[model samples]
Target: MDVVVLIGRILFALLFLGSGFGHLTQTDAMAAYTASKGVPAAKAGVLVSGVMLIVGGLSVLLGVWADLGSLILLVFVLPAAFLMHAFWKESDAQAKQGEMVHFNKDVALGGAALMLFAFFAHNSDLGLTITGPLFHLG
Candidate 1:
């Protein structure tokens, strides 16, 4: 059961980790897309979110301050979902559908992160538990 929980955490963290890498590696492309979405300081947003995702993902993966990581993810995801995936504002059917899918995914991920924070932040029995600085090292 503990192994399963650890695996689950790793799987969940992978999404953010990959995305963070993308943001770092593809800053110019991401910043252009962000600017298209009318985001202020698009480059800065991409860079900051990239750092947040990397830090948050690593924390969750290691079960170290995962609650804080979850909170960080929630902060990044919630606003991003609305700002970036405004499906209702799209006129083209295909674009609308794509945006809707992204919006839904973002919302779901945000909810999952929130649930992780609520559960694992206080309850140690349900998921991976870390003692001291590093769980695997200890």
Candidate 2:
């Protein structure tokens, strides 16, 4: 079960890790797309979000301040779901479907982040973490 938990954590972190890398490495291309999506200061947004994802993903991956990491991710994903992938704003059917997928994906990720935060904040057993639940209630 512990191994399974580690595996799940690794898998979940991979997406953000890779995407964050892309955001940094492919800044111009990513920022252009973000601009097209009407994100103001897209380049700055991309850079900040990229750093946020990297920090959050690494924290979660290592179980270092994981509760805080989970919160960081939740913060990133929730508004991004609407600002970046507004399915309702799409006019074309296929575009709407694609946007819906992205939107739902963000929402789902947000929910998962919240769950991880709950587990970490509660000091639940999360296997294979170097150090965990660095954020704690008094």
TM-score of each: 0.91, 0.94
Best by lDDT: 2
Candidate 2, lDDT over the whole model: 0.90
TM-score of model number 2: 0.94
Q: Write the per-residue lDDT of candidate 1 for residues 1-138, one digit (tens) a residue.
A: 889878988999999999999999999999999999999999999999999999999888988777888888888899999999999999999999999999999999999998878766566454555642221110
Model 1 ranges off by over 4 Å: 125-127, 131-138
TM-score of 1: 0.91
Strongest candidate by TM-score: 2
Give the lDDT of residue 120 in candidate 2.
85
Q: lDDT of each prediction vs. the true structure?
A: 0.86, 0.90
Q: What's the CA RMSD for each of the models?
A: 4.3, 1.4
